[model samples]
Target: PEVIYLAGIIDRTPSSIAMRLVNFASVDPFHQNRGIAGLSGGKKQVEPIWKEFIDNKEDLLFESEKILAEKESVSIDKKFAHMLIGIENLVGESKTREVKVRVNQSVFRQIVLANYSSKCAISGIDVPELLVASHIIPWSKNEKERLNPENGICLSSMYDKAFDKGLIGLKLDHSIVISEKLRSNRIKPYYKQFFAPLEKLKIASPQKYLPKPEFLEYHLDVVFMK
Candidate 1:
């Protein structure tokens, strides 16, 4: 329940355990890649705890990791369900819904990652830590599209941020669209070598859940800088 208790068991400081959980969540290299939002604080902390457990799950002594994984998964699922219902019921009176939103975002990322085969659609970066589940339409623009995998794309973190800030966009053909504004920064080696080279390069489309054209249209109209 308390970090002190966990610290004693693990022979780590309370603060160290807490910080290490963040590190564990940061680099899962496994199924789900959790950002700080999904991995830090309260009920969502269980996700990171599981992330740590998974890192050490390969025990030769016994199936300790397997046991903990199943146990924690069940507990987290039940607790998360109750937490969501509670937050939904208390929407106006409390801020618990924010936690639910974080969980939803994490699940949304997992779905998008699966859709894109856990690599960046544009750069083909396979490192989970470097990829992001980017929304075609800005998340703030469409509530319904927030969790829709068909409205998501896997992009490397740089490309994701670039797409978000509209340093780049996608044409209807799923090709890269670099903004003319980048011309000023084009002197940067990475800009010329990596970013500029991406212009007109086609993004990798999902095999199972193709992104919606309307979402692409919305992104082009509202989010894309040019």
Candidate 2:
């Protein structure tokens, strides 16, 4: 139904759109690794766009959103009015930078959520309101990778806080590792009911852009409690 609606808006057949999606999947590394051969004929057309996304995610993602807004006959600012509310008073480079940052952050969240199929990677929570695009490497610590899909993880609010605060971490194998601080509370009801069950459990693999091992190492070295 969604594909049909999109096809109507774009004046194309639903099959065409479906095939295009398959083409995109063909170019996706995750699908490639899984031995899924999606519409190879259209792969070349989508490959360049995928390369551009990997090379310059922030700019490409913002431009894509802007283009979508234009296609809908709306201004980018108006399309993201709620998220861009507080920047009205600013102008010039400062305003431009702020707008780009906010828009790109929103795009990052969308990409991360889609990667995880809109479910929390750890707990499989499917409620969008309870999910967050948690950064493996702190956003402030890496400007170049701030918007990288590989640097993000979908997690529920509770686990997001736990991961952010070093109460829990992920090993190179993607298994959960409880901090000694959290482990100290093992006898507590909450620990037994929540934290204990997660210890050494592997997170659900994302559909695309698995978290980079380097980012996981950074989190282990710099953020995880001993």
lDDT of each: 0.70, 0.91
> Using Cα atoms with residue i matched to residue i, what is each candidate's TM-score against the true structure?
0.60, 0.82
Which candidate tops lDDT? 2
Clashing pairs in 1: none
For all predictions, the C-alpha RMSD in Å is 14.6, 2.8
Mark the 10 consecutive residues where model 2 has the least summed lDDT.
2-11
The worst-scoring run of ten residues by lDDT in candidate 1 lies at: 57-66
Measured with C-alpha atoms, the lDDT of residue 80 in candidate 2 is 81
Q: Give Cα distance to truth, residue 14, candidate 1, Å.
A: 42
Q: lDDT of candidate 2 vs native?
A: 0.91
User: Candidate 1 at 175: error in angstroms?
Assistant: 0.4
